[model samples]
Target: MYTKKSTLALILTACLLALLLVAGCAQNNPAGNEAGRPEKQGAVTVTDFIGRQVAVPDNVERIGCLYAFSGHVVAMLGRGGDIVAVVEGLKRDVIMGELCPGIGEALVPASSGAVNVEELLNARPDLVFIRSETAANEGEKAKLEKTGIPYLVVDYRNMKEQMYIVEMIGQAVGEKERALKYNEYYQRCIDRVQERVQNIPLDERVRIYHSINEATRTDARDTLPADWTQVVGAINVSVNEELKFLEDKYFAGLEQILLWDPEVIIVNEAGVADYIMTNTQWSSLSAVKNNKVYQMPIGISRWGHPGSLETPLAILWTAKTLYPDLFSDIDLVAETKYFYREIFNYPISDQLVAQVLSGKGMRAPKGKAN
Candidate 1:
């Protein structure tokens, strides 16, 4: 019994037994498998826009909107009270403050560049909504999974994608009926604009130059800016196939714009409208000469962005601007009031409408308040 070989074997056997016992205990534990991860309970699986199967809670009471755009969609669904966290910048946005007042009180600032893991976890949200691209970040995804909080991804790059995003968000937040109602309303607005503008002859359509930021920067055809022009039955003068894939602003020379000589100029950047109006080089342009240069409306989001909730109103307003004679029967003031009331449940004051139309709360055109 005291042999060296026999003693070594007994020690080995005892160590093996200990390891087996530990393994058995871990397997028996319900908290997780052998890896010690938490178990998901009462989770409903949903396929996101990019086809990722996400396990969301059946009842989502507290929500974190990781993107400002998501906040807009959630507000439209009448679920601003459920939002627990949002980007810091949105809290200070005048348009957001006006549209969803409760967001100011309910949301903690999570992050601007990426999801702040600690801040998000402390918020203790039942679910988080983010853009599809944001979810693709491996580090962020891993962190979110470790916290056991579900995240849903939606895309709003185009009109079809926007509808899909709204529908998906509705399902995630238990606002399916409300989402359907809003979609129906959105479709009708699109139809109304399309029916009137679809038949206008190509040569008869207004030629539009949409300034993206600076006077020389513009959007090309097939972009959101181009889509806005098309929706309003106008021709985008900056139709460059080479710039079609570039999402950011494309640079052009003053001479190029002078050559195009657009009939209307819609400025998305602040103060650029006034700059074009007064610039000596741009004085001879038809848009400038005729006082057809107007600033794009900015409220909860820029009307130029494709997926904005106010896009319908933008289409209506732009159509009115481009073809004042044809759209004479439509009253912009009354429609703006109705849209704000019906969608956001906030009755817009006349002063606020002017501010939004004048792009008062937006970034690019600084220092000039309406």
Candidate 2:
């Protein structure tokens, strides 16, 4: 019923709309998200330790990250909005939602050791990321293979290795150029830390006892290389000469720690430091006698892979605490702020930074965690 003029006008409008749609499609390349970097397509073909060829994805819509640390890396790589599930729930669940509000779902399993195969299968992740050190166990590997999910095991990032993992993961997920930029920037942090510590002799270096929830009442002897000790330059007291039982990888005795007698004791509970400082039995140890014991910040305290990123701060603090005269230039607070803003893309104010690095643990800003 349209007039001839109305019909001709409608046809012209439809042609213009088609051209606009084509233009938008042409411009639609997946650029970087709000997190660290985007995953990139790379020339290198990587085969995981498990013998599976790394499968490249066209679009990674869903991801099942297997460790809290891996989850943190995923969050960092700009997938903060799309992670379908994380291992053992959200990595630092208290901080997860608040830290990255865009993510809508978190499917955590009842247990943490093994990747809950059933839950992951249901989540239908297009890709899976597990820190090789934490998640490359036989059971988990078998489950991933049987389920036909492509997974990669990333190494724990220290000052030096952080760039490698960032780029490697970025490439795997299709964010190549951004990962390289991130890699270079991270390398600078490593170089700066190394420059500060390289001059200190091994003997003069602070003997750090990175404690993992060891108390008199609790029968726990969490050892070194397992804790933040995984980071390069972190002295592994658990594997040192005194703790013969640590060699067994099964059981140990208190005599091991007492014998090693580190220069500093890092405690899971801040109270442990207070007790060690005040305890009658602790008077003999070099760390306690000299008042060298201290508390750990977030990732370093956790001694897990996600916490691996905190190695820089841990090193800075240990150096200052151990040889303040030598490490006068090192500033842990500024370094922490840099990592939050530059690497993780979290905008932490100076006040929030103070709360995060306080000797005591602080909850997220929300009274009831979102």
> lDDT: which candidate is best?
1
Q: List the residue pairs that clash in candidate 1.
A: 270-365
* Per-prediction TM-score to the true structure, in the order listed: 0.78, 0.71
In model 1, where do residues sit more than 4 Å from their true spots? 1-45, 105-113, 220-222, 244-253, 361-370
| Model 2, span 296-340: residue lDDT tens | 565323322134445555555555655677667768788778766
Instruction: Give the Cα error of residue 253 in candidate 1, in Å.
Output: 4.2
Query: In model 2, what lDDT does residue 189 have?
Result: 45
TM-score of 1: 0.78
Tell me the tens digit of each residue's lDDT in model 1 across 29-118.
533422422236766677787788887766777789887777877877888777778876556556566556566665453553367776
Q: After superposition, how far is residue 335 of candidate 2 from its true place, in Å?
A: 1.5
